[model samples]
Target: MTKSVIQPLETLRLAQYAVPIPCFVCGTDNMFDAEFCTHCSAPLALAHQADNKKVHPRLIAMVGPSAAGKTVYLGMLMDMLSRRPERMQMLARGAFSITLQQTTLAALARCAFPPKTPSEPERWNWVHCQMRRAGKRQTVEMIMPDMAGEALLEEVDHPHTYHLIRCFLEKCTGAMVLIDSIKLREGAREQDFFTMKLLSYLSELTSNDKAGWRKRPIALVLTKADQCRECMNDPAGYARTHAAGLWQHCQERFGRHKFFASGVAGTCAYRESMTEGRVQVPLRIEPHGVIEPFEWLLSELERSGKKS
Candidate 1:
C-alpha cells in the first residue's frame, strides 16, 4: 500500500530569484539568494539590508598600513559611541556588522591586540550602522570597512588589483588615513611614503572636478600617539616635522584635509610566546582622541550636504 500527500507550489520563491540584486561594493548583479558577490566576494548582506531599510549608506574609508592600528581604533570607536550615546548614537544594522567590534574588544580584554585583517576581500569586516546626533530628527546610514593594510597597498601600487577596494573608494564620502605615530617618530620613512602614494591614488581616481577626492574631506590620523607627546599635542606640527613628504603631498593635492592624533593603549610591553614568537601586549586601555577625527569627518560631510 502507498500513501499520497498533497504538495503546495512555491512559485514566489522562484520569482524572487528572477530579479537580480546588485552587489553593494562592485555593483555586479547576482541571484537574490546569493550570499556573496560572484565577482568581488563582498558579503551580499550589506545590499539586502540596505534595500530592506530603504536607505543609501555613505562610505567611510579607514585606511592605513599594516599594524597601524586600524582594527583597534575602529573597534574602540564603536564601543565608545555605543556606550556613551549622549552626543552621538550608533546602532549596528546586522549581526555581521558586530563581528569586528566583538573580536576587538574581546582581544583587548585579554590584554592582546586583535589579529590582522586578511588580505582577501571576502574576509574583511564591514560595519553598517545608523547614526544620529543628539536632539536631531535626521539619521544617517553609514558603512565602514576594516580592510587589510597589505591589500590596500597592493591596490595603490597596482591599480585594479582589488576591484572591490577601487569601487568602494571611488564611492567614499570621506576617508581617515592612519599613520603609525610610533613608526614616524622612530624615523621610518616607509609609513610616510605609503601614505603619500595612497593619497595620490585617491586624487587620481576620479577626474570630475566636483566629485573628485580633492573636494572630499580627509583626516590624516596619527595612531599610537600616547608614546609621543608632541604628536598627541600637535598632530599637524608633528606631521610637518616627521612626515614632511606626506604633509607636503596632502597640502598640494587635497583641498580639504586635517590632521588628528589618536591612541588606545596607555602602555604596551613585549612578551615571548611559545606558539607565535614575541608579541606586544597592552598593559591598560586609555583611549584619547578617538572620536574627534570621526566627528570632524561627519561634520564636513554635513557641511558639504548643506552647501549642495
Candidate 2:
C-alpha cells in the first residue's frame, strides 16, 4: 500500500510562520497571515505596512461622544488633504486605508451622513497615511482610527471594556476631542461631562510629567459650528461660556490644548426614513474651519519631534 511520490519541501512556508508579527496596537504576537490582532482586534495590515515601509507611524486619537461627527470630520479632513497638495498632501498606505474616504464621500454625495461607526473593534476604520508638506522634505507617517462614541464612553467609565481603545489612547501622540456645538448651544450638560471624563481618562494614562498627556497637543474642536454663529465666531470663548466645566478641566489638566470650530454641512434638514426613524440630511456640501486644527496639531507634532 506504500507508494513513494516526489514532493517538494515547504521549508520556506514553515520558516515564514516561525516568526510572529507583533500587533501594532497591543503588541500581541500573531501568525503573519492574521487579519486582525488577537488581543485588540486592530487590523494587522497596519503592522505589515509599517514593517514594509520601515516607518513608525504616530497615532492620533479622534475622541468624542455619539453624534459628535468624528466620522464626518475625519472623512472630510482626509479627502481634503488627499486632493490638495499645495498645503499638505496625504498618501494612503494601503487599499484598506481608502475605505473611510470612499464611504464618507459617497454618502455625502447622496446628501446623507455616513452610518454610525459600530462599537466593535474590527469594524472601526483605521487610516494609515504618509503626510508631506509642500515645501518640506520630511514626511510624517500617521495612523488615525474612527472610534464609536458609545464604546468610548464605556471604556472611559469601565476601563478595559474595549482593549483597542485603551491601548490606542495610551500610545496616541495627539488627540482631537470633538464636542457637538449644536448640543452645547441647546444647553446639554452631557456633552460637557463626557468630554471632561474623556480628558481625565487621557491624563491618567501616564504619571510621568515629561511624557504625560499634559505636554501632548489636544485639539478641542466644536463641530457643527455652521449652525452656531457664536461658536464659529470664537470657539474658545464659546467653550468657556457654554462648557465651563470642560474648559476649566482642560485648563487645569492639559498644557498644550486649543479650541477650534469646524463644520461640514452648509445646512441640514430632517426626513423620515423607513428603516431608521427621522434622519438628518445635508442640504449642501460646505467645509469651514476644517484644516486649522489639523494644521496646528501637525505643527505641534513637528515641534515635539524636533525637541525630542
Candidate 3:
C-alpha cells in the first residue's frame, strides 16, 4: 500500500465566525465564540439581536452605590408594569433577561429584597426587551443592565477598567442614577460625593460638545422612598438640599433631567438572622413612585425621537 500524504487545512472551517462581530455598545469587534464583548464585557447576545442598519435600540443604565436598591427598583418596575395592563409592557428578549425580574419578584413575594448583584461581568443580568407603549406605532427596544455599585465606583475611580460602563455611558440614550433616599435622609455625605464623582466620570467619558449629557435625559432616582415620607413627597426638592453637588451638576451640564423617588417596600422591619446578622424585611409589597421616572424618561425619549 502506498502511503498517502493529507493536505493540512489552511483556513478555519468556520471562517465566517472569524470575521469578527462588532459590539453594539462599544463598536469593538469581537470573535463569534465570545459570549461577551471582549473589550466592554457587555453581552454579545445584544449585538446578535441588534440590527443597527435599522432603528438602533435605546440603552439605559441603572447606577447607584452598593445597597442603593438598583435591583429592587428595576425589579419592582418590571413587576408593576407586568401587572398593569394598558401601560408599558416589557417583553424580555432572551431567557436570561427574565432572570432579574423573576428573582426580584420572587424575593419580594417572600417578604425579602433581592440579593446583591454579583461583580463578575458574565454573571450580571441584562434586560433586553421590547417596550410596548400605548399609542405608539413601533415598540421600543430597550437595553438596561443592572451594574454592580462597586464596579461602577471602581470605573469612576479608575477609568477603562470596566469598558462596558464607559461604552454604555457614551452611547446610552438616557440614564437613571439611583440615590438611596434612606441613606440621604440619615445624613450620609458619601452618597453626595459618590454621585458627584459619577457625574464627573460620565462627563469625562466623551468630549464632543454636541454629544454631551446636555441632550441625554437623566433621572435622579431616590430609591427606597417608602422609608422616608418626605422623599416620596418631593424628590426634586430633596435633591436640591441633600444632594447639592449632583443637583448643581445636573443644572449646569444636563438639559433634560428630572428627580423622582421610588420604593418597593411599604414598611420594613428589622429581622435578626444567623446568616445575615440583621436584615430589613418588607412588611408589604407597595411599589410607590416606581414608574414615574421610567414613564418620564420614556416620554422624553419618545418626544425627542431618539438621541441626536
Candidate 4:
C-alpha cells in the first residue's frame, strides 16, 4: 500500500473549518442562532431565512465632496437610529453590531467630524445596524466612502485612485451622491463640471458589463440645504425648480435615480475662535429629511426581495 500524500489545495481547504465562526452581522456562529454576518456585522442568517433568500447584503455608497456634511449626516443617522426604538426594532436585537459602533458614537459625541486624515483619495466607514421592518428583524450594513473632490476631478490616468472609485461603484447596490446646495447657490461653476463628470463616469461604468457595474440604484442627494434659507423654506419647490435639471440628467443617464435634500448641521459655515484654537459653532444643527432617502432605499430592497 502506497502512503497517501495530502495535496496543497486539500490542506488549504481543511484550514477553513478550524474555527467555529460568528455571523458577520450578529456575531453568532450557531446556524440556528446566527442571523447576521459576525465579522462584518451584517445579517447572514435569520429565523425567516426563506423569505429573504433573494435578499443580498447591499452596499450603500455615500458619496460627497469634502465638508458637504456626509460625516455629520451619517453620525446623525446613527444617533437617530439609536434613540428610535420603534424605527430600529426591525433590526437585529442588539446594542450595536460591533466595536465600530462605539467609535462612530464617540465621534458623534465629540460634535466633531470623524477621522479624515488625508492620505488616500477614498476612505470607507462601515456601520452595522439592526432594525425591525415588515414584521421581521433586519440588518442594515451601510458603507460610507468619502472621496476628495480634487481626486474626483483628477485625470483617470491616476491608476490607483481611479481603480478605487471603480471598485466601490462596482460593488455598490445603491448610492447617495451628495451635492453642496450652498455651493451651488454660490455660483460655484466647478461643481457643475465635477458633478457632470462624476455622473457620466458612473453611468459609463454601470453600462459597461466588462466593468462589472450594471443595474445599480443611485440617489442624487443635495446636502447643506439648511444654508440655502430660500430652499430650506420650501424644499419641495427647490427640488422641483433648481434640482430638476440634475434629476433629469440622472434619469437620462442612469435611468433609475431620485433627488433628495438633507442638512446635518443646519448652520451656514464653521468659524474658528481666535483664543481657543478650537472651532466655534458654525451653525445650528437642524437635520431635516435626512432619513427619508435611506428609508426609501430600504423599501426598494425589500420590494426587490419579495419579487425575487
Backbone clashes in model 1, listed as residue pairs: none
Give candidate 4's TM-score: 0.66
lDDT of each: 0.92, 0.94, 0.85, 0.55
RMSD of 3: 2.9
Query: Model 1, which residues run further than 4 Å from truth?
Result: 1-12
For every model in order, what is the number of clashing pairs?
0, 0, 0, 24
lDDT of 1 by residue, 97-128 (tens): 89899999999999999998999988899999
CA displacement after TM-score superposition, residue 236 of candidate 4 (Å) = 6.7
Model 3 C-alpha lDDT per residue in residues 210-275, reported as the tens digit of each score: 777777788999988887889888898998888888899889988898999888888899999999
Give stretches of model 2 more than 4 Å off.
1-11
TM-score of each: 0.96, 0.96, 0.91, 0.66
lDDT leaderboard ranking? 2, 1, 3, 4
> Candidate 2 or 3, higher TM-score?
2
Q: What TM-score, to 2 decimals, does candidate 3 have?
A: 0.91
- Better-scoring candidate (TM-score), 3 or 4: 3
- Cα lDDT tens digits, model 2, 43-107, are 99999888887667999999999999999999999999999999998899899888999999999
Candidate 4's error at 257, in angstroms? 1.7
- By TM-score, rank the candidates, best first: 2, 1, 3, 4
